[model samples]
Target: MTLKYALPVIALVASAAVSAEEYQAFVGLNADHYRASGDSETNWKLDGTYFFDKKVTLGPLDQFEYINKVTNVSASFRREFDTNITRIGGEYFAENGLVVSAAHTRASGDYVNEVGLGYLVSNNFIVRVNAVKPEDESTDFMFSASYNHQLQGNDYVGFTAYADDEFDYFGISSKYFASLGEGRFIAAGITLDDNDGSSDWSAEADYYFSKMTSVGLTYNKADSYSLNAKHFFSQNWAVEARFASNTDDSTLKTYSLGVTGQF
Candidate 1:
């Protein structure tokens, strides 16, 4: 694929378990609000990975998020390059459903620096742990794990686990999917977050019309429904976008666009 559509490989889409070698990537554009600003106020990213002889993968990602809000130059709520982040890492496959991965991430604004580990379980489960630290302070750890079980045809059940003070403490989730003929899939999932630091329940869905075109939506208890879309022009090219209301009204809602391809 061209570099334009190669960015999605790193962005987080709802991922189902897959083989060790076969992988996925995507990228696109987005509009979070009908801003009067003259700028695209646009953001972009690139992400992708290749299985190491079908065993492990060297994964890397680069992302820039754009927030569009107009205010005084001194306004803290005004839009800025508030969250530019980049991550690069690798994953090692152990037997069974066990895979260990580590990544280093850097953030702009107030996001602390972090390094993390992820594990994928055979029971169709996923878990992640990250340690974030200030430039002058020690490490602070955060952890989360989630699993989904297929029941009957397209219905499934899942639960979320969290540790060390994140917005989401824990949640129970369920999802359903329907395959509408060839190359078309529609899916939806609902989850309720534990604790009350800000987040609540969330609902999301995606309708993939083809290998190259798709649309999606998400609603969080903290805000309104967000819009998501994607299009892949060819086997080697795809673009994707996500836009939503700021979960924290005190924070700014934003949009992210990404592109990707190999040399």
Candidate 2:
């Protein structure tokens, strides 16, 4: 499957709306262009999410979202090579702090399944275990944990850790979000991943000029980086653009554009 970087952009847009009321539904359309080794390809993706409860919000730079009891359904579709890659998933967050999620994905005529169980240990901490199975592979188990604490108002710091049984992979990351007052905010994060005996590092930073506009940059140890920006025309609609290039290979690049809607 093609690597999809859209989720980070989506999260950035959602975080920019920290002071605004949360939306009950979201839809996004994105186009990606890739050029590598003198070959180029383009693909399109459509994705959406619907919240079952109106009270659930990405509160305080999205750090306190675990406190909200909500259920949500999400799905996405991508077209490449005249074939479709599709996924559908749903999550239920119970009032008692239990969380359940399941998803199914189909790509290249093969299916993959995933299920997870989680618990909100507290308003600021959560843990989860997941199992995944591919059409021709054994099931793999993964574990993850996250903790976030509010510093002040909309400012917060968070840490996360993850491990998977299949690849002997382990990773840890940390992020800090600062609300600069007057609709401005800045956030940064660093991640370190270890698979078998190999290691990789990545970092990202973002700045929100206002509740409706933001820009971000991301870098990987593998000599690749991306810059992206997003702006909302109104409370319910937005547009985004991104450019990425690999430092080791000047000819390898990617360009993307996206449109998003909230209601």
Candidate 3:
């Protein structure tokens, strides 16, 4: 997608609403090499979170990837109402949009704000729906859901589905944990996407070496593939390298390398 087309969707999503718990703080440098276009770009990223109290937190996040030359940055604030009740929060994306949300627990059942801004929560599943109104354009609604089951210990399976005005996709994924020498486990997933009646699928596999090293490979029905590897030198430091290619059309390829740190 071009910048003009992407910026609006990103802005709309940001205006609507958005998770991983990796590090409390981090910064990184990245290099992206695009073979099909014979172009190389440098990227920088920084992100951090601060706690004001046991129930309140603030976050400043920023990231740069070589996709359409877009950079993402956001400021977020979250407050926990109680341990298993409602947690209210909102985020503002720089020059983008604003999102407000609340998350509840299964014991608390489902909830909807007076303005329709809440999600359904359960012990094993979650569903969220939101609407976005961008200036001078039609409103877009997005919905996503995930279901997870724990077979035993850390072994589990999951299903995810997402839909919006212009996109629809669904995926099923699972991971099995065991001791195979230095390797800990393997994970696999397949995603099907309906892109305006033209459907495509992608498959992915990942192997984890301990908790600090891993490699992943992905292939799409559109004749594109990607490989990425990550290794941590310490609990607080890591490096990642990735390569991607498309065999069709101009035969494009992209490579990236990054070093990261966590507080």
Candidate 4:
């Protein structure tokens, strides 16, 4: 590869090694192969959340900790195509069902900041809005709302709407679970994404042999399909593998393997 592309990739890999996400933490690597381009990439990711349950005074300022029932600090790093993206954020959770979060992200040499507010309207619905500002770029907004209702054990239907600068879409998704045997269960779901002019849909089915092992298949209206499998060695560690392909122009394909751990 040319030096122009190589330097950024090297820097990203180095930066990701030191930086670390969710209330659940994970680190993983992905090996990806592109069929059409005959190129391959190895991606590294680290992210997780650490929570402070008790109030601890930090210097002279308590900030919002007085009203914060739960303080969660999160960090994430992604290294791909020889470039690095890093994010650090914190969330303040209040007992009155309000959550506020702020995060800063850096990519290459540019930076962006995001602020988000969310509320749990009820047990089945949530509304969220996020404002994102990137240095030297136009500020953008994203809004999302979702509602889910359970009909029986582990079976439910849901609706979601999402909007951003480029396009707005809304759709419904549902999961219906059935017992296959003594310790096996299967689930099937369908999702539709209605864009500004056209609509795309996908269907998925997953079979779980136990609580920790499952395999799934997905077919999208975009003439793409994927097969995926996951196995958990323990409560804290798991691995995943997937193969995907498309039938459109270029007929691209990909294969990937990754592992994750929660702390």
Candidate 5:
């Protein structure tokens, strides 16, 4: 609309062209949006990942290959009610000509493995398949497809709808970054999720004190408030911790800690 916002959009376009090289490993966690009915929630996760690049080597015919393993645990608690989860999965990424991937995931209690896929368009757009399997209840099938669109202003909006237990959701979000003197910055954003027929709104902001450390705060319908802190050991490694408390007339609170690294 205005130059103030146009400049940021141009910057994103410039940064988007750089093709990412081989990816190895990464891990991180947060404790926001921790509840289902707009109450307080928190949990921790420990993850280990090993995988290869997803980019294709376009020749006479495109080709690529990579596989990975991941595992993590998360538990939620309140003054009384609680639900805990453990997840483990394996994935394969292959590009004999067209990119194809398959994955299996399992979570504690009743969470089951979900499967997904992607078809690339330009440098930004993609099509994804999200499938979920239930472990405790009568099998529920969610066959959904979605598109990701990056706006000229660098904002993102996506849409999705399902078949059985049918519903559609629209999400839109934009980010703002402000320099707080010296080498520090604060990034904030507001997100709206039109899930089913209800509209939920949330705003979050994080202060990056330096290259090695930062903290964040979030206010969402699910969690009244959440606080997070992160300390980076290197450009590729970091550790994080978070605590969240419910705001509604519920007793759900969570604390999570985790380490993340790229190698």
Candidate 6:
């Protein structure tokens, strides 16, 4: 479905879900604008997730202690190089740690389809594999794994790695989150990607003023940087904004705004 139609459906579903005595769901909408070298593009996305069971948390850590069944759906529309693109996707997480996902994307009369399967190795680890096929193109397989470890109360570290068969591409990233007491925390991460004979890296750091407000900065080896901030108006509603620029090309920039609701 297109984002224009999907947004109202998301709002209606979220509204209906709020009336249920026991329901866990989240819905978000985002709009982004990009400009580079006197050219511009715009994108819109609507996404949501619904949980079938209550989320279980670990003691004092604010981390998930177990996996709960859930469904995720998203639709996006974008215009790039005067061509319009649309994508729709959904995923289902089974209670038994099995995950199944599928997506379809169309752009300039061309289409692609992807399917993936994932499993939770443990509460803190997961692995996934995906197959993607584009119209008139061969299918490609991709694999990914992630792990997270809690160091102490509300502090943790995580690692992720992924690669694809057809495109000799590989990437790995690690992040650390440190609690600073009183609902405040700082996080930093670095990612490295290798494709063909080239390598690139990016790093980001974020600070949280409280559980409900935060800001972050990200920089890449290519001299591009972005700043973002998020604030919650209440326990269940939030707004976010972001700006990105490229130092190598002063005219290249991006801006985005988003709103989210959770119950």
| Best model number under TM-score | 2
Candidates sorted by TM-score, best first: 2, 6, 4, 3, 1, 5
Worst 10 residues of 4 by lDDT: 57-66
Cα RMSD of all models vs. native, in order, equals: 12.7, 9.8, 18.1, 16.6, 9.7, 11.3
- Superposed on all Cα atoms, model 3 deviates from the true structure by an RMSD in Å of 18.1
Error of 2 at 125 (Å): 0.9
Write down the lDDT that model 6 would get.
0.78
lDDT measured at residue 124 in model 2 versus the true structure, 0 to 100: 88
lDDT of 4 by residue, 100-179 (tens): 88999998999999998887676577777888999988878778777766654334556666777566655556555554
In angstroms, the error of model 2 at 129 is 0.4
User: Could you tell which candidate, 3 or 6, scores higher by lDDT?
Assistant: 6
Q: Quick one: RMSD of model 2?
A: 9.8
Q: How do the residues 61-146 of candidate 3 rate in per-residue lDDT, one tens digit apiece?
A: 11111011112222322222332333232322222222234322222444333112323354456565666544345656767666
User: Model 4 residue 215 lDDT?
Assistant: 90
Predicted candidate 5 versus true structure: per-residue lDDT over 105-211, tens digit per residue: 44444456565554544333334455666665554444444444544332344444334445465565555544454546556777776777788878888787764
Runs with alpha carbons beyond 4 Å of true place in candidate 5: 1-23, 27-44, 54-85, 90-101, 107-111, 136-165, 168-186, 247-253
In model 4, which residue pairs have backbone atoms overlapping below 3 Å? 8-82, 9-82, 21-47, 21-48, 21-49, 21-75
User: Who wins the lDDT comparison?
Assistant: 2
Give the TM-scores of the predictions, in the order they appear.
0.58, 0.86, 0.59, 0.71, 0.55, 0.78
lDDT of each: 0.51, 0.83, 0.51, 0.68, 0.51, 0.78
What's the TM for model 6? Answer: 0.78
Better of 5 and 6 by TM-score: 6
Error of 5 at 109 (Å): 7.4
Model 1: per-residue Cα lDDT over 1-263, one tens digit each: 86666656433222322311222332222323433234335443444454343221111111100110111111011222446665555556554545455555556643345565666654467677777777667777778777666655333555666666545455566666554655465667787666656557889987777545778899877677678777755445556676665554523555656444422
